[model samples]
Target: MMEPETRESLIARLPDHADTTAWLEFVQLYEPLIYGIGRRHGLQPTDATDLVQEVLLAVAQSIERFKPDQQRGRFRSWLFGVARNHSLNKLRSLRGQPQPAGGSEAFKQLDQVAAPTSLEQEFTTAFRRRAFRWAARRVRQSVQPTTWEAFSRTAVDCQSAGDVAEDLGVEIGSVYLARSRVMSRLKRLVQEVSGDGFEAIEGELR
Candidate 1:
């Protein structure tokens, strides 16, 4: 099984959901999550891609429905549900493969024992955060500290450029300069971490 994603990473990715940046982030962070779901239902790689595409399309269509509800559910389970449905449909459509009996019963039992929202959300949040933290650390190690700090403060911490400049005792122009450098670094890092596969997914959205 793949390691879990952290909350910060997931939240960071969400802010840019419709953008190419967010699409790459999603593939890097959640590809394994989708793959795991597909494998659980006995899907091969091509089938897994089909399942992943369907789930991603569902996410794209219903993204407006995603309100960061710290109250109701985790994106993980809701997304897993989409993948599960798609995977089952794929499995059902396959010819000659014997349908395993009691799988639906198994799902019912699994649902009965489902993890509580708090626990599952906590786990997912932590997992996503760690992933972003890893990417952030990569930038920190490779890029200048000032640049990383500027982006981290403005983008991750939600500080305005003016506020970041004020906090860092720098001019507002420096804040803009730093932001430009950081954005360039992020684009490169995103590509390095996720690759061209994400571009294909984004093309589908377009």
Candidate 2:
């Protein structure tokens, strides 16, 4: 397993054409995360896709500014914040447009629409999102391939656990245990990996 220190160093090594390899690495690591958050915000498929692109573009511009402190949370939070902001802007634009048939009523009834969140709050949300991703990825890497596949098929992909068990030719109880094991490890890994930044920030606070 790569140490947090190693990961940090690799992430920070972006200036010397980090664009060449590091950028690819970063995109691979974060694209799914950004896309998932966009979908969560009620964006349509095309809008969600566009939102992810815009979010990645923003991240490309702003990631150099992130602190290494884990306590400040994972970079995911900040990324999510950016995505959330973009999503809201898109929503607002949609709201301002003439309704398409029944669209006005649907939008009007969406009481859940609130003012855009502060950047800090958005960042906090992104941090949780990233932490979950980080934890899940780490657990996937650590476990047996078959077990990881089972967990991913059911939990990550939102497939029915029973269906996954049937496909894997495993008992329902085994499916439950497999999912739990992956989830448990994921929680632990995120806390451990994310704590590095927190520790660094706390030292400064003291």
Per model, how many backbone clashes are there?
9, 8
lDDT of each: 0.60, 0.62
Instruction: Please name the candidate that would achieve the greatest TM-score relative to the true structure.
Output: 2
Q: What ranges in model 2 sit over 4 Å off?
A: 1-10, 14-18, 69-72, 98-110, 113-206
Best by lDDT: 2
> TM-score for all predictions?
0.45, 0.48
Kindly list the per-residue Cα lDDT of model 1 for residues 1-206, writing each as its tens digit.
23233344444455455678667667767766676566655666676788888888777777666654552444566665666677667766654455355444323333343344544444344434435454567678887777778887986687899988888888989888888777676555544443322232233323
**Whole-model alpha-carbon lDDT for candidate 1:** 0.60
- In terms of lDDT, the poorest run of 10 residues in model 1 is 196-205
Question: Model 2, residue 104: displacement in angstroms?
Answer: 5.1
lDDT of each residue in 1-206, candidate 2, tens digit only: 32143354435655445456666655655566566555555555676688878987776676677774743445545556677778767666778666555555434423564443553454444544565565577677788887987888887688898898888898988888888888777655544544334333223323
TM-score of 1: 0.45
